[model samples]
Target: MAESDGQERTEQPTEQRLRQAREKGQIPRSKELGTAAVLLSAAAALLMLGDALGEALSMVFEQSFRLERAAIFDPATMMPALAEAIGGLMWPLLGMFAVVLVAALVGNSLLGGFNFSTQAMMPKFSRLSPVNGLKRMFGVQALVELLKSIAKVVFIATIAIWLLWSQFDHILRLSGETLNLAMKDALELLLWMGLALCLALLPIVAIDVPFQVWNHTRQLKMTLQEVKDEYKNTEGKPEVKSRIRRLQQEMANRRMMAEVPTADVVVVNPTHFSVALRYDKDKPGAAPVVVAKGLDEVALKIREVAREYQVPVISSPALARAVYFSTKLDREIPDGLFVAVAQILAYVFQLNAWRKGQGNKPVPLKDDLPIPDEYRV
Candidate 1:
C-alpha cells in the first residue's frame, strides 16, 4: 500500500491521478503472462512449420555429404557449400522469430494497453544510491520475484522428470532406428514436451496477472490528506473560492450603490425593499430603467444614499416590491408596471415644478399601484 506522512492510503485513485501515473510510465505488467504467451506461440509455430523446417534440415545434411572428394579439400567449394546450408535454414528461423515477437508484444500489452513515456526511459540518479539500491534488492517485489522463479524451476523440473520416466522405452527404441526415423521421433517428443511446459505456465500467468494489477493499484492508492490536496490543486480550495465570491459581491454592491444617487426616484416598501428607477427624457417612449435595487439592509443603504443625493424617495409598497423582485439592476421595469411608474414620474415632475413656483401642486401618489400577478413575491 502507498502512504503519505505515515497515513495509510485507502482511497481509490482518481482519473487525474491514474493519467499522471501513466504519464510517468507506471503501469501493471506480468512477466509470467508474457513468458507463457511467447512459449505457447513458439510451440504453435513449431507445430505448424515443423515439416518444412525438417525438410530443409534434411536437404542441408544431404548436400553437406554429397561433395566430391576433390571438392571437399577445396576452400572455395567448402565456403559455398556452408553458405548454401545456412541460407536454406534462414527463412524458417525468421518465420518463427516473427511469430514469437508478435506474441511477446501482444502479451505485454494485455494489461496496460500500450504506453510510451519518455520519463519512464529517463534514468534517476537517486536509484544509484547504495541505500536505495539495498532497499530495492530486499523489497517485497524482489521477494515475490524470487518465489516465482523457484516455483517455475520446480514446475519445469517436475515436467522434465515425468517426461523422461514416461518416454524411457521410446528413447531406447530411437537408438535402434534409422537416423531419419530417430530424428523424427525425437522432434515429435520434444514438441509434445514443449507444449506440456507451456500448459503448466497457464496457472502461473493467471495468478500473476491479477497480482500485478492489484499491486499496481495498491501502489497508486491515495491517503485522505493526499486526496484533499489533489482536490485543492485541481478544483481549487473551497474557502478561497468563497472569499473570492464575497469580494466580488462587495464590489458589485458598491457599483450598484453608486447608481442609486443618480436615479430619478427611489421607490420603497418603507423598510424591506427599495428600487430606484431612471427615465431618459431624450428617448421619449422609453420605459423607466431600474438603476439600483435591494432587499432589507441593502434597501436601507440605497435609501440613505438617495437622501444624501437629494433624489425623490416615494413610499409605494407594492410598486417597490414588484420592481425589486421582477427587475435586475440597469434593466427596464416590465410592461405591466409601465402605467404605474409613469404616474409616479409625472407626479415627480409636477411636484418639482410646484417647488420652483412654476406650476400648481400635484396630487399625492397612490399606494396600491398596478403590479403583475406573475411578478408578485
Candidate 2:
C-alpha cells in the first residue's frame, strides 16, 4: 500500500488517476495468461495440421536423403535440394505461426484492452540505481511472482509424471511398430500431451489474472489527502473561487453605481429598498428600465449616489418595494407596473417643467398609488 504524508492509501483511484497511470504504461498484465494462450494456440494448430505437417516433413526427408549418387557428390545441387525441402514444409509452418500470433494478440487484449504508451519506452536513470534494483528484486510483488513460479513448476511436473505413467504401455509399443506408423503415433501422442499441458495452465491463469488486476489497483490507491488535492486541481480551490466571486460582485456594483447618475428618478422604500429608473424620451413607446435596484446597505448607497448627482429621490415605499422585487437590473419594469411607473415619470417631468418656469406645479404623488395585486411584492 502507498501512503501520503503518514496517511494510508485506502481510496480507489479516480478516473484521472487511472488515465495518467495508463499513459505511463502502468497497467495489469498476466504472464500466465499469455503463456497459456501461446501454448494452447500452438497445441490446437498442431492437433489440426499434424498429419499434413508430418507428410511434409517425410517428403523433405525423402528428398534430402534419397538423392542420386551424382547429385549427392555435387555441392552445387545441395542449395536447390534445401530450397525444395523448405518449400514442402512452408505452408504448414506458416499456418501454425499465424494461429499463435492471433492467440497472443486476443489473449493480451482480453485483460487491459489495448494501450500503446511511448512514455513506457523512455529510459529512466532511477531504474539503473542499484538500491532501487535490490528493492524491486526483494519486493512483495517479486515474492509473489517467485511463489507462483514455484507452484507452476511443481504442478506441471506432477502432471507430466502422471501422464507418462498412465501412457507407459503405449510408449513401449511404439518402438516395436513400423517407422511410418511409429512416427504417426509419436506425433499424435505429442499433440495430446501438448494439449494436456496447456489445459493444466488454465488454473494458474485463473489465479494470476485476478491477482494482477487486484495488485495493479492496490498500487494505484490514493490517500485521503491525495483525493482532496485531486479535487482541488480539478475544480479549483474554494478560497480562490470566493475571491473571484467577490471581485465579480465588486465590478458589477461599480457599473451599477455608474448608472445611478443617468437615472431619471431613484424610488425608495423609506430606508430599506432603493430602485433607480430611467425613461428613454427618445423612445416614447418603451417603458422605463430599472438601471439599478438593491436592498439594505446597497439601497443606502444608491440613494447616496443619487443625492450626489442631484437626481430626484422619490420616497414611495409600496412602489419601490414592488419594483425592487419584480424588476431585474437593466430590464424594463414588468407590464403590470407600467401604469403606476408612468404616473411617477409624468410627475417627475411636470416637477422639472415647473422648476424651469415652463409649466404650473404638479400635484403631489399620493403614497397609496394604483399598484396592481400581482405587482405588489
Candidate 1 global TM-score: 0.64
RMSD of 2: 7.9
Model 1: residue 297 alpha-carbon error in angstroms? 19
| lDDT of candidate 1 over 213-270, digit per residue (tens) | 9999988998989888998898778898999899998999999998987799999998
Score every model by TM-score: 0.64, 0.65
Q: Name the runs in model 2 displaced over 4 angstroms.
A: 2-4, 239-377
Q: Which residue pairs of candidate 2 clash?
A: none
TM-score of 2: 0.65
Best by lDDT: 2
Give the Å error, residue 207, model 2. 0.5
Cα lDDT, all candidates: 0.89, 0.92
Could you tell me the C-alpha RMSD of candidate 1 in Å? Answer: 8.8
Candidate 1 collision pairs: none
Model 2 scores a C-alpha lDDT of 0.92
